[model samples]
Target: MRATLDFLLNEWLDVAALTRRPRFADHSSETFASVLDMSERLAATEFAPLNRLVDTQEPHFDGERVNLPRETHEALAKYAESGMLAATQDEDMGGMQLPFVVEMAASAFFYKASIGISSYAVLTTANANLLMVHGTERQKQVFAAPQLSGRWFGTMCLSEPQAGSSLSDIATRAVPDGGGFEDDALGPRYRLSGNKMWISGGDHEITENIVHLVLAKIPGPDGKLVPGTRGISLFIVPKMRVDAEGALTGERNDVTLAGLNHKLGNRGTTNCLLNFGEHGGAIGYRVGAPGEGLRCMFHMMNEARIRIGLGATALGMAGYEASVEYANTRSQGRRVGTSGKDAGAPPIAIVGHADVRRMLLAQKAYGEGALALALYSARLVDEQHTGDSAAAKDAERLLELLTPIAKSWPSEWCLEANSLAIQVHGGYGYTRDFAVEQHWRDNRLNMIHEGTHGVQALDLLGRKVPMEGGAALRLLLARIEDTVEKACTQEALREPATRLAAAVARLEQATQACAACSPPEAALSNAVPYLQGFGHVVLAWLWLDIAVRLDGRTDALARGKQFAMRYFFAHELPKVDAWFSVVASNDPTCLQVSADCF
Candidate 1:
């Protein structure tokens, strides 16, 4: 794992060059390695030991507070002590000011060890990062500071009981306090009343307080709510009320954890269905201007999406490691070759079998490929923040185009990797006897995390593909072509390069076909298929690029990359055609399906 990450960071992406940039000038490759080492040791010592403990004894509500094991709190306290909760922030804020790319690589260790326990810190960091970008100085001091220091945790309340992902229909209402309280110290104080469901890390006992970034609609003068997303606004509704000095007032906010959700996995974090203003309207301080809630919330949502991708990639790597460990040590079969096996010969390790290797190769293709894409996305983030004007503009465009792909590809394909890991373990994988079953169960939430699979599909095809007159799509394809052009120079890589180029051309044709359809919905009706095809093509391009970098390498790691690249092109890349064929043809079978047929 270290070798692979080193190759990706230094060789392929050239992350070391980032140190020359002013923000990271205080750092070096050695510092990045130290961070990675710390993360690995911490995860191994603290988080991994508690993976099963948290799963078996999931958090329970004793009606007074959510009950969690003492070990969970201690483990998180160690995490907070590491100063990693805000690794990418400024030095004045007690952060290392490391590149986001390096920060993400270090974070993968935690997710790999135990995603369930790691989720608490993940959501809190994402929430605090959002506030840093959009919150007022006072708001930042009162709310975001404690979170960054790990003294407080945060949660984002977007989905409600009646409206799931459809934020436009959210009915949460925030009314102004008419008793001379509009000019309250934190911000404009309002009374928020609504029920927020599926709130992860919503309520927990490990921290001094929880900051709820709630979305609610402020009533107009006519006492009627606005009709759509434009009317929504963001608010900082803390669980415990605070004074102007950021001191706890010892008064509980009107927020209630009505019930706890029993999920299949990721059971370590407390998922709550919270009722705001059950007794009276919960006091909320507006974050940004009214009617700008959706826009502001999406900032956090996009960051969360990529983080979700990282979690998926980590979980996939965990499963791969487990299955590979098992296969190399468990002798159950003989090597299958051109000739038959001898009856008197002893059985070899299962790793010698052709089918087991096939499964492992597929897992490698999906898991490592997902990791590459994730790190690439993180690098783009550094580019956007640190690069010069034109470079930053191009990076932003590419980042926008790849966000949904980054989120959805790993979420879908890596879950498949976890499944194949189970298959490699055979029956033992099915039972709780092995951790792969738990890995599969935990990964199941990713597809539905920030958004469902279909939601990401719609975002990819309906919005991202055509946004800014398709400039972002063209930029991404041009980069892929650059990789293709380089690979065509080598005899060994030429075949896969040509294959990837053909896939890119097919995607272009599909995009044109969808754009030419009479009604936009006709093109988007097959959005999921389009998303699948698009993601595969992207992965193919990444693999070919990695192969281009490895043309002269003869080591085992290089050999593994060669095999996985070949396997993906042979077994996985061809499926891109089937996914794109529907889009290119503008197949209306799905759109034309009658409800009566169901």
Candidate 2:
């Protein structure tokens, strides 16, 4: 992992130069190295040891209180003490002020160790970030500060019982308090009355308070609910109200934990049904202008999407590591060509088999390539914020285009890697004794949450690809071509360079073909295939990028990277041809099928 991280930071991204910048002056390679070390050690010892324990002993709501394992609380406290919760915040805000890239790298360790426990921090960081950007000064001072300090946790309460992912249909009402409420550090308050569903980290006793960023609609002049997302607004409704000076008041908000959601995986994280105002109403304070909830929530959503990708990548890496260890030590059948009559023949390690190597290589390609993409996206976020005006603008555009892929590609592909890890373990992998089974189970949820595969495909094809006259897509294509051109200059990378170039060309052609389709719906019918093909080509480009840098490496790790690069170009990139063909054909089979056909 250090090798992978160092290659990204020192060789590819030049973290030293990034640190020397005025904003990151306090950071250095040595310091970031120490951060990574601490993260990995804490993950292995403190978080990872409790992963299975928490999984088996899921959180329970005893009607009045939600009970979690003591280990879960201890793990969170350790994470809070690490100073990483505020790693990327401004120094003046009681943070270490580390770069976003380094912070994400550290986060991956915890995700790999235990996603359920780490989710509290993820939600808190994203919540704090959102508030810092849009919350009022008083709101930031009262809510965001404690979240960064890990004194409180946060949740994005959007989906409701009747309306899932359809914010327009949300029936939650935030009626402005007409002097019945007293104002504190947070601004004017309201009475929020509605139920929120599937809220992760929604209610827990691990922290002093649970900050619920609830989405609700205020009544119009006629006292009727405003329709659609345009009328929706964000509110800061905590489990318990706090005074202006960050001290908790004895007053408990009307927010109630209705029940706990029993999930297929990630059971360690409590997903809950929260009633915002079962009583008169939950005292809520507006974050931004009324009816601007969706726009504000997108900030947190986008960050969570990228974090989901990193989480999936980490889980995939964990499975890959476990399986590789098993392969290296587990002896299996003899070489294929060896005779059965040769009693002297010895069993070979699973890694010695060609097919097993293929599986390992595939895992390596997906896990590491996805990691690189996530980190690259984080770096883009940095550039968007801190780079010069033009660079920042370009980075913003490119990031918008890549965000869907960053979220979906890893969720789709790394889960495949986990399956391959299970395959490498054969029968043993499916059993509880092996960790790969749980890894697969844990990763399965990522594909569905945040957004489904179909949703992301539509976002990538129907929206991002066509947005702004395709400027973002064109810039990305140009960048890929530049990488292709660089790879062609090297003798060792010429073949892969050619292969990747061809695949990218197919992707480009397919994209244009779909874009040019007369009716948009017809083109969108093939979105899933288009996204798959595009992701493969993107991974191909990334492989070539790594291959070009690996020109003079003689070490085994470097050689492994070279092998995975070659494997992807040869074995994986070609699959894009068929996928792109499906996209280019504009097949309407799925769209044309009748509902009765099922």
Candidate 3:
């Protein structure tokens, strides 16, 4: 882990140092700080020490039940009991009402310790968020309250065997029972039947009850699949029914834990195949209006996407830290200039090697840049909810534009950092004796989590960039330009700022070229290039921002910040030119291919 700390020290720590700036002074106060400190301590002491044990042990499930590691359960209990579970929730719901920014920072500690274990907390938090937004009074009283109190856990069930990204293809159905729907004396309920696949924390023995927020189609009178997402409805389906006193009843609900998925990583969290209403109809309470389930679920999906990005960033940091430490201490052959014919020279640290330094620097650039991006997006979430109306609207638009990049870019680049981690350790990195290999394996999963790179690229170029008359993209560009302009006045930052400005101009031109295409599909075909181009511009701008902030600091600690800024500009910033060229290129080669060319 020394390598990981080195990467953080060389890259991410600069950003943390810059947080002392007045612009970032809005972070939470006493109560929030206390909660964050407690969370950090628990993550380091309770969660991190068990990461290797949990990963090797893995979660197990019988046909009827699921069992997690004892350490996993203990860590989860500590996490929930400490009020970290309610960090971002509203005060009315027995929460601390902390901002998303604080929650995100707190999450970094958990994720850095063990992403697989941290996921249980993240999923529950997201579930509570969705419930707070859409759940009815009684539903909130029954589900959200207990979850907030750590009495129950939550999971979101969306994917199915046949339906992956295309929700319209889902076969799950909720048919109306007696009198247009079973009019529950407490509230409206439905008979739900569906098989949900790839559900994290689907069935866990740690909590008394598991609440699943499922997406199922409810037929209408005219009923031709309710015409896409409009037909889908959100349902709160519990593992077991609870009595008036909130105690579990005798038998389980129709929901059954069909099987546990043996995944490549994140083994600590049980990913299960669940069958709702397999024996009998599973009783479910509607979260919101019928046909609005997809909208409601998006609330959770968006939050999860950000969390996935942060997790990916944290994993990359861990890998980089581990690799850097190995490079610094591990001794290898003599330097290139030394003569070794007869005289024996002492072995030098691997970190002194040029190629090793290059890999370490690359890891530092990607990991730190990704962390900054994720945190910035999280701060935007806080602004959207708590700021003034106009500020909130701006924050929302910027967030929509940034979310795909935040989710996809880190997953792509940080995984690269993990690969470099393995390379740094040579043969040792490939072995289980060191954690770097595990970090690589774990980081690999994020590339497909939430959404793939292709999916996010398509979303970026095909939808989000064009939404609301391109207002979001325009706002983002303006913000980047503003940062560039501010950096231009700083002598140390002017050159890099100008370079970033040029990249921004190229991106703008590419956006216009794509917009002007006769058929939009022509433009959409280059979405990947566009995404890559946009990400480069964003990272360069962030690096320039860091450089400008560091320029004003004169403290000894700031020397590291100065070195990182110089290294980023000298080595990393030049790649923006190549990315811009690719973005601006009009290669019709892909579109020109015939159907049977092969």
Give the number of the best model, judged by TM-score: 1
Cα lDDT over the full model 1: 0.92
**Predicted structure 2, TM vs. truth:** 0.97
Any runs in candidate 3 off by more than 4 Å, and if so which?
Answer: 1-32, 180-186, 222-224, 243-247, 336-343, 554-557, 570-583, 586-598
Looking at model 1, residue 469 earns an lDDT score of: 98
Cα lDDT tens digits for candidate 3, 100-197: 77678778889989988999888898998899889877777888888887889999999998888778888788866568554564246777888999
Return the TM-score for each candidate structure: 0.99, 0.97, 0.91
lDDT, model 3: 0.80
- Name the weakest run of 10 consecutive residues (lDDT summed) in model 1: 334-343
Query: How does candidate 3 fare on TM-score?
Result: 0.91
Q: Which stretches of candidate 1 lie over 4 Å from their true place?
A: 179-182, 337-339
| TM-score head-to-head 2 vs 3, winner | 2
Query: lDDT per prediction?
Result: 0.92, 0.89, 0.80
Higher-lDDT candidate among 1 and 3?
A: 1
Per-model clash counts, in order, read 0, 0, 5
lDDT of 2 by residue, 1-598 (tens): 6689789877877777777678998788899899999999999999999989988999998877899999999999989989888898888888888889889999999999998899999999999999999899888888998999888999899898898866789999999888644453577689999999999999889998988998999999999997878899999999998776768898899998889999878889999999878879998989888888889999999999999999999999999999899999999887776544344689889898889999999999999999989998999998998888999999999899988888988998899999999999999999989889888889998888787888889999998888999999889889888998988898888888888878878988898899789788999999999988988887787778877788888899789899988888888888999999988888889989999999
Sorted on lDDT, highest at the top, how do the candidates line up? 1, 2, 3
Q: For model 3, what is the error of residue 342's alpha carbon versus the real structure, in angstroms, after optimal superposition?
A: 11
Query: What digit string (tens of lDDT, one per residue) describes model 1 on residues 1-598?
Result: 6678888998899988999999999998888889988998999999999999999999999989998999999999999999998899888877789999898998999998889889889888888888888888899889998998899999999999899999889999999877876578898899999899999999889998999999999888999899999999999999999999899999999999999999999898889999999887999999889898988888899888998999999999999999999999888866566687776788898999889999999999999999999999999999999999999999999998899999999999999999999999999999999999999999999999799999999999889989999999999999999999999999998899889989998999999999999788999999999999999999999999999999899999999988999999999999989999999999999999999999
